[model samples]
Target: MATADTSETVAHNPPCTRRGSKDLPPDLRIVLLGSSVSENSGVGNFILGRAAFDSEAPPDVVERVGGRLKDRHVTIINSPQLLQTNISDHQITQTVRECVYLSDPGPHVIVLLLKHDQCSTEYQECVEKVLLSFSERVLQHAIVITTQEPTGTNDILQKIIQKCANRHFSLQRSSSPDDLLQMFDNIVQMNDRHHLDCEGLQNFSMTQQPTEIFSEGVKLNLVVCGSDGTLKSAISEQILQQTDRRSDMELHGRQISLVELPALTRLSEEEMMCQTLRCVSRCHPGVHVFLLIIPDAPLTVEDKAEVEKIHRIFSLSINKHILILIMQNSEHQTAELNKQTQSVIESFGGRHLFFGTKTQVSTLMENIEQMLEENGEGFFSTETFWEAHMKKLEEMLKKFHSLQTDIQSQGNLPKGQ
Candidate 1:
């Protein structure tokens, strides 16, 4: 429960002795991993490189990125913006060797920060090459973090887990300090309690496949409510597809059922209840992840409180089956924006994840797919439901046709009359 921010709660002094060489700073033992390209490089310039890390990175950043373990704190140990040797040139092996030779013994979290859109056929070779040459020992101490959103219907993280056959891991994806700290804290706790680090955590036996990704017989129904302009339809669609992929339900041989809720909007309380509760009641025995899409515009404290009140009321009615997904919008680029967004969600007892819509659609779909593949249950075949939806569509179209016919008939007679 005592996290990096809560270090004061657990101890009076810093937890670890500085472990790097005497040349390294006295209170730090940090290293940087990933494609460490400099500011002048490709997409790495904006994201993948040194600017993301700082020796004087705020305290929260340090705790989230480098977890505290016993009396020896493990920080990223390499310099920022330093590229690993090219693997195909065979220099990568030597570079990793040098890092391993220099790195201290015992447990460390190797943050694998991969570039975005690197899953294409062109970059697949490089991705595989890095994974291949990166020693198991290094991987065992690793916490793979994908900086780029995976392009397919599912996230690269979910793909990796599925490829490994539902193997569990402590992997994470986030740029927020609070989420990062929670991730680090979870890893450290898992390590201490289970005698395992990140790698060990990944390799541990996940007796049953995670319910989020797949359920044997259960159905999950989620309702995501965010501000207007969030990807409500897209989120719902991805959840549908991902669950199909991960569940035991037959995708190729049988049909899976799907019931989608109508888009929620600002409306009267009576209308809101009729829409939300109706959807939930219909999707009974299923888990509902309510996405609260928030815009980046400044919100007064009263506004924040109002949103929290709404969330609380919903949670009480629904029993906390809601996952609050914070849709990442353009206005939320500032550090202040990040802090406020986090505070608002945590205050409401709901979990949150960030999504960048400006990125490729494939990546967005992939994130949703990952969630469903990680969370869905029951069958995906929806023959009966689709039939019903189509019937409704047909009825609406018939009414429209009749109205057009009436209007044309009236127009033809009006001039003469």
Candidate 2:
């Protein structure tokens, strides 16, 4: 079982590490919430001490990863910008709870990043709205992390801290890696002063019995989904047959998990689409690559439009974790596909695969491997952009059905009559 054992959850005990109180620190669990206030917080990269965030970009959900800091096991979770995004309050809490469980037992600290480039009323309201998700005592385990690192404490920085009730810290884009360690140390000390610990977290009730999503949180599930149901099912089956094998060649370097979601079709119900997305996001906290399997045949005009609509339903951040999977039903269609699909596939850059047999699937796995490698030592991950999907769904449904309204307004197509 690849489950995170009790030892992993217990901060003081680590598997394969020397056990003792020889200047060792307790395990630290941190949840990072990003806002327009802190676009440049760089928490993920800072924790890993290397670039971890996809394209080194800020995340939209709790992108959790394990790290060692001052000899203590550290689990850091990064979330999307709450203030800037239009996801409902309930959904924001859902993301927060996702972080809490990923941290399991409970998080040691909640770092709310604030970027004060232009302090406006909305930014202030953002802080208040975020606090609403947590209990009033949350401030005790919380710290206001300003994006701008302090060279010497100045009036500008001090005012922001005072505004946040003096529960604030500053970090700069150019700050050295050690500075992050110091910031974390401060959070731990502050929590200690308030007498907060894992026991306090239980009383807070943030980590309830978890919901059954994705069958117990596998390390990484490469979600192969797209418009063509038949091709997708075949691709997923092939990938898994090799995934569970003991042959190192089949599952080398990392233990990979495969999740086969139903097709992301044009005819999908709004509820179904939302649920599918939520399941993928909630179940897997590690990095993931999304394989959007487009058929090898030339897409009809309507099919092309449907693809565009699917792309629009999520925020642009999703592009980072996605690879366009170009699947041919048979080798015979290669020439026609090359003429048409090449143009569409090229846009995803080098992140794509020409899917088929073991050799072809191997190439796809290699591409995915490269993605995970770029993410440093962590698992392959996709940014979570599902929170605002309600609005995106509304926009898509309108665009899909309102085409007739626009056609009627024009009164007819030219020269067809």
Candidate 3:
């Protein structure tokens, strides 16, 4: 059996040959969809031949882990617990996006895990909802894996299996890793080696298209602000240079403009205010997204102060439009995040990504699009900027008055002498 390799290291390793001569793709991507985290993670671990995913990971967050299995590089995307009755549609949509994002092009197999004896209408409905969340044709690429022997009397389970063209497997009956690998291969072969079409996965239907956020005339204005000035400049330059820029300097077809903002701490108070106003003006009506580039290192006092200044200038609500871009050093990438870095991310609504040196432009754009979608296609408008400015003025005025009152009270107090 092939042992699991660390996901971080898996990408850099060479692909191995598979057991058969079926001419399978080098990568086998599988997505685990189930109600039980333990069952899902267990199956994931079983397939990868190691415990790569955390069974205790938040039920709302989808995770992906990759490893080399025999001759093929296998990637498993563990979806959030979507079968619960209380799961919201938004949560479902978010999970679908994350799954698609993690799976990249798409998963080759959708493995639905379930207990053999557990059958209920609600459970079936939830399963259907999840399956349809990807696409109606997703069933063609699906397989049902039951914990125990699937009995003939379980109508719900039978119907699900039938819907999936009877592609079923018993985890208990499958004794070796090869059995599971073969199952995945069968699905790949049945589908003619084509992965699930992800172009439509963004909208949950083959016919539906993603909203035209970057419609012909509208340009996406991005402001790259962060404590790490060098990283910010590098990211901004990379984005501008790599994208297809037109004669007018805007990106062709989908227009995108990137502006780099230096650390506030480096600027004098007057320069800081002027720079903020200048950025807002250059972005015009609004800034679509603020890619706050933080180096993949512990936050220094200057970094914290810069972040605080950003919050003060943009208001706490600015977090809705902020996306943390952690510039990771390829040689120093670690599994664990810095505590202060994590806290900074949490403060910004947990919107972050570890941007390695080799990260692509598409990945950054996708994150920006996801953040925009979450914010209801809204941006930090000029009105919002002024509102935050006024709020800051109000706070300063209150503080000034309080200080004046304290001074008066001290003068009125009995002589300290």
Candidate 2 global CA lDDT score: 0.53
Predicted model with the maximum TM-score: 3
| Candidate 1: segments with Cα more than 4 A from true spot | 1-214, 237-265, 296-309, 315-319, 329-339, 358-417
Q: For candidate 1, which ten residues in a row score worst on lDDT?
A: 1-10
What is the per-residue lDDT of model 1 for residues 173-217, given as tens digits with 9 covering 90 to 100? 323233433343443333332211223322221111233343444
Off by over 4 Å in 3: 1-22, 149-152, 203-417
Q: Which pairs of residues collide in model 3?
A: 16-71, 17-71
Q: Over all chains combined, what TM-score does candidate 2 have?
A: 0.41
Off by over 4 Å in 2: 1-25, 36-41, 56-59, 148-160, 163-167, 173-175, 193-417
**Candidate 2 lDDT tens digits, 209-314:** 1112223333455665565545665676556554444355433344343443443443336534553555466435643676777776677675465456556654
Clashes of 3: 2
The ten-residue window of minimal lDDT in model 2 covers 1-10
lDDT of each: 0.39, 0.53, 0.72
lDDT score, residue 345, model 1? Answer: 64
